[model samples]
Target: MPFLIVNTTVTFVALLSFRLLVKRMYALVSNSKQESYNVLIVGVNDDSIALAEALSTSKNQNFNLAGFISFRKDHQRIKILGKPIIKYGSKFYDRIAPMKITGIIIAGAQLSITQKNELVDKALANNLKIFSVPEITQWTDKEDVTSKIKEIQIEDLLERDAIHLDDSEISNYLKNRIVLITGGAGSIGSEIVRQVSSYQPECILILDQAESPLYDLELELKEKFPDVHYEVILGDVRCRERILNVFKNHDISVVFHAAAYKHVPMIEKNPKEAVAVNIMGTVNLADLSTQFNIDRFVMVSTDKAVNPTNVMGASKRAAEMYVQALQQNDNVSTKFITTRFGNVLGSNGSVIPYFKKQIENGGPVTVTHQDIIRYFMTIPEACQLVLQAGTMGNGGEIFVFDMGKPVRIMDLAERMIKLSGFQPYQDIDIKIIGLRPGEKLYEELLSDNSTTLPTHHKKIMIAKDKPLDYNIVCIHMEDISNAADSENDSFIVSKIKQLVPEFISKNSVFELLDKKINL
Candidate 1:
């Protein structure tokens, strides 16, 4: 009886110790979180409530809802978890400037760009961070909550008012159409196929030289859009016979030409290939479209094509000129249109994917230059604007999408680092590497001679740039093609400049061309 009592007493003491340890651990964790953040809510609405609730539930996020603030007089003054709603204007911000407010969350209906700017400016001036949820109806709410909320980016601040598309018109042009996309396995091409498939295209012919990616995309599309007819063809666009065969075999009605060697470094090393594929390849497809009487040919061009500085850009500009030239051809039964835009957010070789891979590897994310900036759009938005441009085209027109403001690469890298749940400099280090060959510090949307005309879709605009004379352009193209065929890189490069005098070489051995040409 004595031994039994002793054993029971020992067991009871151990249990008590375990309970005390667990209680202490819980207190430590709670105190740490309480020390981390104090968040202020502004413009209470559904989004604000959702954000508040999310913060309340997340143990990892150390946010304390300080209270609410409003500019309007009629909004409800309800307490969220006993937090009071206070009316604050410019003076209130000054009063709370010294408090431990980590950030302000703005949520409500859409506000004018001017009003939004004013709010953001005030927050920055007071040394406080600001975040906003998209207006009620426009909110996608797609991002994972684990992703840290970011300050309002320059893109959000400088972009114009959102433009709504006429859905019926877009649907009418895409529905039941047999669409052919060159480079269909690539970034822009794949997105075009995806979006078009959503609109119930009768058949989508995906063509690319890369066999494996083409096959993979084919399988994915087959599964996703099982009801839509899909075909994958592996062929080079530079081959006239192959392009003609595909068009004839498929009876392709709508064409999206997105195939080209786009990497600046690669193109500079082999200028002949750029000319062969970008210039001659485009001509082959344009001429074939005329022979086959394709309904629409939408050519994807880049912002680099505006006063180009590299061989790749020059070649694309030449392609654009060729498409414009073909529009004047009486033999072509196709309506040729070109869409010009800038870098996509997560393209195959884009910086976003590169940064993501770097982050996953656990260390430093590299930026080319601190001051370098470029226009950006999401892949879906870029592809959607392309479709919108195609529907609004009048044969020879060049459509440019409004890509909002240019974002500095350094800033983007920092934000991406933060979004990945790492604090810049503390968790992940950023290395500033020098710019690559033929890379621009900033990209421009318009040329000296180009001007914009508003479109039915506010995001899409028409470029009033001069179109080259078809006869002259054709002669220059023939010379370029012969030079490429003969493996003469110098002659081909020279002819490219002659065709488009705006071609300027940066960080290239071909800089001589820029000095020689007076345009």
Candidate 2:
């Protein structure tokens, strides 16, 4: 009995020692991680509070939430997480310069451009990595917390506020109108449908070749807007008779034509397919809209059409020319308009999803060219601008959204990597693959020949360009369409260049076709 009691006591003592050692180690780790980062929050508003909370909760051992700072005098006395807010002036930086501040997050709301620039400049001068929270409301709970905290991008530095549209005007045109979206199931087309539904359109006819996505969108719209009438038609834009039949049956008053083969690499390999859809499909819709006496036909175009370098761009340019030519004809009742913009951030084929997939797969993210740059807008933003353009269209006019400045693809990759909570070039390797077929080093929003005209909305501008002759354009289009039917790729591409002399080919395997077909 004595021996058993002694053994039990020994075991108890060992367990206690183990627990104490763990506790000490844990406390040491926690203390080591508590190293305060000299963080400077720009605005002491809700965004600042949320950012403070995020910083406090972050596991980064180096981060220290120093204090808050804002240009507004009212925010000076405001306390974020019990830290006093400091004014971002000369003395403020001087006072904090002594302390090692790893980074500065500008959470200012409704800040003037000059004020934002001053803060950014000061942060940079202090050798601090700068970040800006555009508005507190932009945040969502589901957002990746780390990724949401991003470096101050050029968009943030521009200090331009988001354009506010005249909702009444949009509602006037869209409400109770039978709307037809050709690529209704696609990223842009679906978004158009969504926004139009918000206006309580009389009926929405969603036409797309893709069955699964079309079905999904149908169900979603049906569930989300039970009061709105929705129709999902499984038909390709390439089918003229089918598209016309739908227009005739539904009496679609407003047509949002977004269907096209837009993937550059895929289109480069299948130039014929690109021509059939982007060009012929567009022509079919424009003609049907006019035939059906549609009120407006808004064709979704791209920056690629500016000076097309690939089959996809060339096809889109041809489509634009077709719509423009139709608009020139006095007989056509439909007011045709084109909305040209660059890549969307979270679209089906956008790089954001690609990078996300790669990151989730624990793989090396692939970037085409380190120096390549392109304009980007959120999917919803692009669609909203499209809807706004549709309302502002007088006819034969091309509206381009102010996509701000172009973003370097490499820098975007780096930011995304950092946002993913991984040290770029350390945790995730970014592989620079050469530019793909029809891809550009940088995308251009407006050509030298194009001039901008202001609209009611600040973000949207009208591109002034000479209209093409409808008769001549139609003749060339007919020839191209005939060649497409013959499956004679060379004849079709050649005729396209003859119509619009700007078509150019890049990264294509068809060198013979490329040489023969010069725009």
Candidate 3:
């Protein structure tokens, strides 16, 4: 009877101490809430719960969790670590407004683009700050999860669903292979380099004439991918001797040829340079690849190459033809593949940067044409598609990415203005400038005569075009190359038109050539 009493007394004292500690911790948390920023998290799934727990313990004491905003209907009404899920959908406005919520945290990748836009617009209206979780693929551990929360950008608003890639297939093709990227410093080429580096290639030879960008890329690779062997060659693709030397020195088996002059108006102004670089430069590379018995040669082409109406597009189309013709050579060993894609957002010389500059100048944002519609994909997405296309190609296949519905320039301008926290036309004026030379109303991924063949991946398709006579293509290419050497603009334009019969000029000086041919 005495032993039992003693045990009961000890248990009672321990329980009393634990209760006191719990009360003390709750009081401290309640006190902190008064000074902290109240945050309501979006989504109620496992990721959201994990994010809330991470934020609660973060060193940055600014964020205080208020509750949850249910994104998943099934997970609704459930408490996340004892925090109430007070509101969802339209009901959130009343509850959130009353809670004195200062910020919103979109905590999971389950939120759709439409949903995000609605929520973000509402948050902006309420004058509340907004942050979104990183992509689930990017998350690995509990540490640093809060650091991934960032202020959303216009690009984020326009992002499509994450692309699921065939990692095994890509690894098999790229592993231990000596790869070469021609324009390695440019936006698209640089992204290609970054993604390809992760696959453990034997070595990557970055060949570009630009020194500063190449240097920057080398430094970045050194920091991020120290184990990957890479060589930065300061050389232009136009130089046959320089390219030949590099190929001779390195055991280059796979080549991603991304070098070319891409600006349409600039190429229109200097047709000879466009021909020399886009066409002949490609010829130089293709010829060398064939000579070297390269395992795979993937040329990056543009959507403008379809029924081309400008110097840049015609030049790219001509390059495509030359590369395609090379496959017909009975003695050729290289499998030449061309991957055509639309404009990549954030690429140098793209309209997004130009519009951003115009917006920053605090005046009118210029649009080439109000109705002009073009397809757009993020730089990383386009490069991944390029790599995937390279893996899927058997020989001489032109792969076109399935860029979703075309977006109007006017709509894009308005959205960008709104994303910048300004009202379109009220805060910032939009001016519709006439189409520049070589500009088009719309872009085409395939020509009128071409048809698409479905691939294993839904986002990519094969464009089967009419077969070109290799001998004839060679003759025209030779003439164009000779004309380029002569630096005769009219002669080069004439030869390109003759070479690509579909090369019709638009708002350009070469339009007269089209009229003359028609007459």
Candidate 4:
């Protein structure tokens, strides 16, 4: 009887305290001469409704609910909480002054940078502060985001539209399966591990040679997902014996191959390492996946593999060919898939983080060329699409991601500087360094002989590339392996050129090899 009374008293006291708090907040709003912000919420939907309620009932905050701005085309004159919700149009500026709106809150709406910038600029002209409700990108679709509000961010402008995923399909594809992630300590690989862990996979085996990053991942996975089972093995993809042993011991249902050297200039200087890792390492994994009878093998490829001017691109192209040829063999049961995309933002050694560090250190940010442009995707966004594409693939498919429009490096630098509250060329100077070896002005998603077929996901497409004979491709693969064993730069470049005839060198010593071949 005493325990029941105590529980009942506690519940009653909590309700009583909330009622008193609301009463006090109402009195403060009524009497205080301080300017209260009549905020306009953006995009009226399920998420916005919750935000409106929170704002209405907030205490110790000088906020008054005005109305919502409909960024969607299907705008309706709906009344939310006795406030008028209006559509944003040419007359929006007129309505804003009448409504006495002091601020704008974008509630989980996906607007392009152009559209958002226009709105923010117009609101700023009218003296309105902009805030946004952040969304949860990974783990779950839970949007418990109405509790807090934050000022706008740089990612809010640069990141692409909010992607809608089929969660049920993703769960079915990953649940209870032993997923093996090669290079699980890297940006893309580590994100795959996190996303995969959320789906309750049977076991997550992370294979990476890097000790520090792998150990850090182990700590994060254990702390964030204590229930999820995972094991980390310090192993390199170049070692066939180590990878073979992993496949032999674990019943790995799926594989995400992300291990490879990727820096173009470094790989250009040392093409032998690129051959050994990007080419030979991929060969080891592809051959072992076939031998182990793994269900799905997803290889992370690059947009550089399209036209292939550099040895890095050429090496990755050779690996792509080896797997596609292996997939063409009638006897192989493993479904081989390759996802090709351009630079991932905020990835290790990517220009954005490098620029951020340089900006913090006080002046001169370096751009290779003023005209240089490349596609950008966030690390999490790329991994989400990878999981989605992995579920959608059957066999022998190179999935091309729709990476929106290419962004100029110069523009990116200026915007980043401005976003950091500094004037470009005044507070910070961006130096135009000459293009390095193996660097290109722009990146292409498709080669001349390939076309894309649309998939269920609008952001992903299947490339119907030129056909290759399995026997001939395998013969060149062996020859490249032998040339790599010889450790001769000319020998490696010669064999790679034979395998990928489109491999023309640019701004490098290897261009001489191309000239000799042309002569």
In terms of lDDT, the best-performing candidate is 3
Off by over 4 Å in 1: 1-43, 50-77, 81-160, 219-224, 355-370, 414-432, 486-488, 515-519
Please name the candidate that would achieve the greatest TM-score relative to the true structure: 3
lDDT of 1 at 318: 93
Determine the C-alpha RMSD for candidate 4 after optimal superposition of all C-alphas: 7.2
TM-score of 3: 0.88
- Each candidate: RMSD: 6.5, 7.2, 9.0, 7.2
> For model 2, what is the C-alpha lDDT against the true structure?
0.80
Cα lDDT of model 1 by residue, 223-338, tens digit: 88888898888999989999888977887778999998888888988999998888888999998988888899999999989999888999999999988988887777789999
Residues 1-519 of candidate 3: C-alpha lDDT, one tens digit per residue: 999999999999999999999998987887677545678888777778888888877776667888888755665567778888865766677777777888888866678888898888888777677878875667877657766887566666764777779989889889999999999999989999999999999999999999999999999999999999999999998899999999999999899999999999898999888977899899999999999999999999999999998899999999999988889888988989999999988999987888888888886999988799999998999999999998886688899998876889898888777666677898899998899998899999999999999999999999998658899999999899888888678788999999899999999988989889999
Where is the poorest 10-residue window by lDDT in model 3?
Answer: 151-160
lDDT: worst 10-residue window of model 4? 136-145
- Candidate 2 TM-score over all chains jointly: 0.76
Residue pairs in candidate 1 whose N, alpha carbon or C atoms collide under 3 angstroms: none
TM-score of each model, paired residue for residue: 0.76, 0.76, 0.88, 0.79
* lDDT, residue 247, model 2: 75
For candidate 1, the TM-score is 0.76
TM-score of 4: 0.79
Sort by TM-score, best first: what order? 3, 4, 2, 1
1-519: candidate 4 lDDT, tens digit per residue: 999999999999999999999998888867586545778888777667777887776653556778878855566556789877777888887967777787788766556678887887677556577788754332133433433576665556764676777878988868999999998999989999998888889999999999999999999999999999999999999999999889889999999999889999999888889888999999999999998888899999999998898999999999899899899888899999999999998888999888988899986999999999999988888898888888887788999998987889998888777656567899899999899998899989999888899999999999898658989998898888888877688888989999999888888888899889999
